[model samples]
Target: MVEPAHPKRRRAASWILAVVLAVFVTMGAVGCSPSLGSPPCMPPEYRVNPSSAKPGEAVTVSAPDATCNPRYGSNAQIRIVFTDAMGVEVLNTTAPMTDKGGFAFTTEVPTPTAVGEVAVYAAPEGVDWCDDTGTNNRAGSGEDELEMASCAKPMKPLTITK
Candidate 1:
């Protein structure tokens, strides 16, 4: 019988290659697992002045420059949504982008049947939620962040009182 040269080295190399292949396969499986959902979008620099306010009071909502992609240009607009504790749409308004790609608008707070706190968010008018494009269609891996679009975040909760 003819024996191969350096049998021990060949065996070790084969074993190592098998282990590496297995690890790669396992990683790919977990990364592409459908159990994971799209990763959360990156938070914007949204802010609500006077975090607390009364019904009908004027409050300013502003997002600093670079909050939203300026690529949208001058025509771009941001929708400022105010949702009450009950998940009610208390106020919804659109603010035009400033020269610096930032937005500032003042609007009166709306009265909701149940008012303890209200969440203020500024969403880019034409932006979409982040989605996973991986084979498994899962998002939890955070790879979505690289391709994510603008995402709104809750500013300091606005308190509403009688």
Candidate 2:
């Protein structure tokens, strides 16, 4: 006659099976799971309302209704660079991120040292959520790496009228 299985052996075998099943279930869930209603990743969008400002005038830079990839989520930071006609940096500031993943900043142009145009550039710094190349290259792929919402164009020429 065959001997019955020992109680201790049965219990231990059951526990091991349970642990293995749990691990398999977790892996399956992670592998085949779909994203549940997540926002699309997009490059940070920015715009300076006028795109041009006179010396001593206050200009508003806006990052409106923007979305970042779920990978980055809401951990992105925006920076604005204001440069003069001679490519001299005038103002560099970090704008505050909004609840909707947007930002806005207001800065006054400094008195002109000389009469010429000033250029402004808005870009996103830190992690980039808009990257979709799947290479996970957040540094960007050249000039296209960062989003250029609006350029100063010719930037407004400053005139020192006495």
lDDT for 113 in candidate 2 is 27
- Indicate the TM-score of model 2: 0.50
lDDT by residue (1-162, candidate 1, tens digit) is 987779899999999999999986875555323344422332246778888878888899887775322344567677788888888887787889653347788988875525688878776665442333322212232243444435434456778877
lDDT of 2 by residue, 80-159 (tens): 77767666777778776653447788877777523465556665565444444444424423544455234232232333
Number of the predicted model whose TM-score against the real structure is largest: 1
Could you tell me every candidate's TM-score relative to the true structure? 0.55, 0.50
- Please, what is the whole-model Cα lDDT of each candidate in the order they appear? 0.64, 0.56
Best by the lDDT measure:
1
